[model samples]
Target: MPVRRDRLRRAGESAFGALLLTRMILMTLLALLMVTGGAWSSWDTARDALRPPQGAAGPLTLAACDRERCTGTFGPSGETVALYQRIGREPGETLEVALRPGTAEVVRTGAPGVLYACLPLAGSLLLAGIVIGGGLRMYRTAWATAGAGIALLATAFALW
Candidate 1:
C-alpha cells in the first residue's frame, strides 16, 4: 500500500514538472518582458500625472476640440496648450488646469487628474493577465490582477 501511494505521488510530480520546462519558462519570461516594455513606455506620462502638479495654474479657455484632443489658452499669458483623451469637456468651457513645464501641454488637477493618471497601470495589468494565464499558466493570479485592473478602470469612470 505504501509503495502504491509513493508511485502515485511520483506520477503527480512528473505531471506537474512537465509544465515547468526550460523552454516554457523562457517563453513566459520573454512575453512578460514585452509586457513590461509596453508598460514602461507609458510610465513617463503616468509618473508625471501621478505627482503633485507643478507649473502654471489657471483656467483654460478651450477653443477647438476634436475626438483625440482639445486646444486651449492658459492663464493670463494665453499660452496655447492641449488636453488629450479626456471627455465631458465642451468648447469654450473654462476648466481649471495646470501647465506641464517646458511644454505647451496641460493636465487636469484634483480628482480627475489622479484618476486619469492611473489609466496606464490599469491597461498594463489587464495585459499581464493574458501573459500570466497563457504563458505562465497562473490562472488564479491572472484573474486577481486582471480583476483589480478592471475595478480600477470602473472606479475611475464612476468617479472621474
Candidate 2:
C-alpha cells in the first residue's frame, strides 16, 4: 500500500512538471506574438495618422458628440460612418476627417490622430501584462509592462 502511494505521488509530480513546462512555452510564444502584433498595429496607425489617404478625405456632418465616440454622415452620397476619435467638436457641425485605410472609421488629423494611434500599442501591452502575470507568474515584469501601458495612455490623453 505504501509503495502504491509513493508511485502515485511521483506520477502527480511528473504531471505537474510537464504542465508547468508547457505553460511556460505557451506564455513565451504568446508574449512574442503580442509584441510583434502590437508594433505592427502601432506603426500602421501612426503612419495613417501622419499621412492619411487622400481618396478618403472629406467633410462629415456630425450628428452626435460624446466623450469617446462621434456619429456622423459623410459624402454627397450620405454614407453613414462612425468616427472613433476624441475630438473636441460639437454636434451639428461639419468637421473634416479622413477615413482610416480600408475602413469607414475616421481619425482626426494632427495631435488627436497621433494620440489615437498609440492606443493599440497600449492595449497590447496591457493584455500581455495580464497574461504574463497570471499565466507565467512573472509578477514584477507584468507590473512594469502594465505601468508602461498606463504611461503611454496618460501621455496620449495629455497630448490629445
* Candidate 1 residue 123 C-alpha distance from true site, Å: 1.7
* Candidate 2 residue runs with Cα over 4 Å from true position: 1-12, 35-44, 53-83, 86-88, 91-106
TM-score of each: 0.70, 0.61
Best model per lDDT: 2
Candidate 1 Cα misplacement greater than 4 A, ranges = 1-19, 27-35, 52-54, 86-88
Question: What number of clashing residue pairs does each candidate have, in the order they appear?
Answer: 0, 0
Q: What tens-digit string does per-residue lDDT give for candidate 2 at 5-109?
A: 678898999999999999999998897788678878988767777787867767789998888878899864377777876556688888666777667787666
Cα-lDDT of candidate 1: 0.74
TM-score of 2: 0.61
